[model samples]
Target: MPARYFTLEEANALLPELEPVMAELLARRAKVVRQRHKIAPILDDPHGDMGGAAATEMALDFVRITELVEQVQAFGCLLKDLNTGLLDFLSERDGREVYLCWRYGEPRIEYYHELHTGFTGRQRY
Candidate 1:
């Protein structure tokens, strides 16, 4: 697919909708993590069947995570991290494609990086 290049204003404007979805994604991810910890012993057992409750919750968590991820992608943005709620909107600057980075709690989209540089290369928007 052609890249969806968002302007700074367009990226920031998506926050109201994106923030809540990111929040829910983080919450569901945390639940999955905690549930995995709780079931680690059972999972380690060679022939262990994950008990009904844990299995059910794990399945639910996976399904919910998938749904939340799809919602985020429907915005034509990349979800970088669920735990930290990092997102990147494909954008163009100075004649090149870059990512406009936003974390969960930031007031607005204020950082960006080259496509190959990743988060550590974030520059002020």
Candidate 2:
């Protein structure tokens, strides 16, 4: 379990701040993917000139991705999937630990799942 846990209200309160970060995260991630595709062909060529702008931009994207990930973690939540914008916060449900799940576009946290289960196992909380 994570060192921090969040109550429903506390988790909901973070939504407003989280939304904008997620938007940027999603956009930056997409940009990185596209950048990677552009450079993939030359990646294995050790002699290929990778010092160009594309490589530099990709490196910057990766750095930004790391920064964004750390920002989310600083909020005491786990980023489960980038493609779906799934986030999980540690919380106790019933009698045991579970993840309070939130997906992109959802107004607030409305679901949870066991540690072993992922999105498909999410149940309304």
Candidate 3:
């Protein structure tokens, strides 16, 4: 699919929808991490078989995480850092493509950066 570009207003409008999905994504991610930690020692035994329940929970978490991730991509936004809750919407500014950046807990979209710049290069919008 071709890239979808957003105007500033359009990107702002998506925040409400994006926030909840991100929250779920983060929650599931944490669960996955916790589940992995729980299973790590067992797996280290080399001869240990992953118990059915633990395996099921991890599989479910993975499926849900994948679904949540696809939802974000469906909105044409990138989930950059789950740990930091950073999201980016592709947009054009001054005739150049840039990522309109927003992090969780921020009031709204207030920064942007070049396609190659990533978060550190973000500038106030």
Candidate 4:
């Protein structure tokens, strides 16, 4: 699919929907991390089943993560960082393509960055 450029208001409008998904994504990610830690010792054992129950839960968490990510992308923004819940909505700036950057917990979109740069390059717009 082609990139969908978003005006500032359009991007902000999606926040209500986007916030819950991000929250869910973050929660699932935390589960995966905790489950992995619980199963870490088993993972080192060559003959271990890797703690079957915990492993299955972790696998399911991964699937849910993928679905949550796809859901966000379907809204026409790029999911940049799963760990930080970062996203970038494509937009034009000064006649050139740029990203309208957003992160989890922010009240609204307040920053942007050049295409070649990522979150670290975020700038107030």
TM-score of 4: 0.93
Residue range 1-125, candidate 1, lDDT tens digits: 77788999999999999989988899889888888888889878878885568978899889999999999999999999777999999999999999999999999999999999999999998
* Best-to-worst ranking by TM-score: 4, 1, 3, 2
lDDT of 3 by residue, 7-49 (tens): 9999999999988998989888888888898887876776778
Tens-digit lDDT string for candidate 4 (1-125): 77799998999999999999999999999888888878999889999996788888888889999999999989999999989999999999899999999999999999999999898899998
Which candidate achieves the best lDDT against the true structure? 4
Q: Give the runs in model 2 whose Cα sits over 4 Å from its true position.
A: 44-48
lDDT of 1: 0.91
Q: Which RMSD values do the candidates have, in order? A: 1.6, 1.9, 1.4, 1.3
Candidate 4 structure lDDT: 0.93
Candidate 2 lands at a TM-score of: 0.90
**Which residue pairs clash in candidate 1?**
none
TM-scores, each model vs. reference: 0.92, 0.90, 0.91, 0.93
